[model samples]
Target: MRDENEMEELESVVERMQQGDRAAYEVLLDRFQPSVFRLAHRVTGSREDAWDVVQEVFLCVHRRREELREASRFRPWLYRMAYCQAVDVVRLRSGKRVDAWGDGEEAHAAAPEAGPSARAETNALADEMNRALSALPEKFREPLVLATHGKLSYEEIAGTVGCPVGTVRSRISAARQLLKERLSAWLGND
Candidate 1:
């Protein structure tokens, strides 16, 4: 999931955290909060809920830090907690599934220099993409979001979602195909 240097940094941080270093825990929080929020937001489709999930994840990590046997396993362990917490929040909150991908702020912010027409086009495309993502089944959507937004590998996704690596690959592939089918018009495939 992370590059070698990043993984090394994570391992060092995790080792310090295992030793009850509060500063190391802070480092972990600072390093992973955004990506964790992104994964939670994509899976839960609510910024508020995602924030809740992120808080719960870090809390759990801090409480159960000793349960982690390997420093190398910290990343996926954190992500698994995030994935589970987000799903639990969705289940508790009226059983409504994740219906939107994100608020499109990131998409808009990424292209702030664009002309008005270009911004409108970007917004339109973002809307279409969100719709396509929302239409996917949860089984497919979860793995895809974990891979794309969480930046996790298939093995990591499999571990987080509690499935085999092959199943994760299939779900991600199927999700992409579904998205392609849904956005064919925007993609100029018509």
Candidate 2:
């Protein structure tokens, strides 16, 4: 219900987009860039990689605007594209086809960058949280980020991930459990 306003705004942009309004797409980009980059950042675990992932995401979305059926779910749809784009970037870098069930660590999902900071304790905790997230399997990481940070619903996540709604719920539940166990201090209320 709340997202209606967001959808309405995006719909206007998408309509203009459909009418070949390049400017409208730019507006859309401005609106969603923060969330898109965050999703990319989580997936790639690097600011630079995330930036590249976002550019790819927008390009892919722009190319596929004709295929969008649910503007109300624009945010999730955008996220799915960002997710796939991140995966693609990682695969291209590694020069291998991504097997979803790949061994462990997935390496590229390594911790996001953090340098010497004025607040060492906070920096250390942030680094630890990222490491905990990095240790998670990709299946869990994507669902958790998309659901918790992306603020996507189970149904919307199901659509984005091309999975059943129940599966989305189960995956998010499993991810939450893992985070609770591994990042108890950072997460709090374990």
Candidate 3:
């Protein structure tokens, strides 16, 4: 369920956006930029590519603002757009299928603030997690990222990925199991 305040705000933005208000579009961009970047980064596995995706997504949103009927559905709709754009970027760069996998270097580079030993451990774990997530097929990776990183409901994920709810559920479950198996080995549990 959407919060009343957020819903109201979104409605206002949508209304203004539909009126060709650039400021309103800017507001929407500001609100969604970080999430858009994160989703793009996760999908494309390149910060530069992610930035390009963000710009293209907002441009597409602005161009198609009138197609949006309900402000409440904007989150999932926007995610769908972002996902598509990121996939396109990946395809264009690779000239092949979309390979949704990170190199693990980016994950290791952005260490959280902590003591040296703790930070080192955290970096190692993060790199391992990135590698595990990268190994997942796009079908599994998309839903897992939407559910966990995007904080979307199963239904929302289904809508974003154009899959059934049960499929989304299964993919996420399978992805989690794969990650657990991979990480367990890294953690010396296997």
Question: Which residue window of length 10 is worst by lDDT in model 2?
Answer: 96-105
Clashes of each: 0, 0, 0
Ranking by TM-score: 1, 3, 2
CA shift of 125, model 1, Å: 4.6
My TM-score estimates for the predictions, one after another, are 0.78, 0.71, 0.77
lDDT for each residue of candidate 2 in 1-190, tens digit (9 for 90 to 100): 7777877877888788767799998998898899887776665656787799888888888888878876666767788888778777766766432322222233324433533352454555556666676677877778877886666888888888888988888888887788678878766764
lDDT of 1 by residue, 1-190 (tens): 4578888888999999999999999999999999999888877778889999999999999999999999998888888788878878877885554644676677778888888899888778877887788778989988887888789989888877889999999999999999999999999997
CA RMSD (A), model 1: 3.4
Model 3 TM-score?
0.77
User: Which stretches in model 1 have alpha-carbon errors above 4 Å?
Assistant: 94-100, 110-128
Clashing pairs in 1: none
Clashing pairs in 3: none
Return whichever of 1 and 2 wins on TM-score.
1
For model 1, the local distance difference test gives 0.86
Evaluate all candidate structures by whole-model CA lDDT and list the values in order: 0.86, 0.72, 0.81
Model 3 residue 88 CA deviation (Å) reads 2.0
Mind sharing the TM-score for model 1?
Answer: 0.78
The candidate with the higher TM-score, 1 or 3, is 1
- Shift of residue 70 alpha carbon in model 2, Å: 3.5
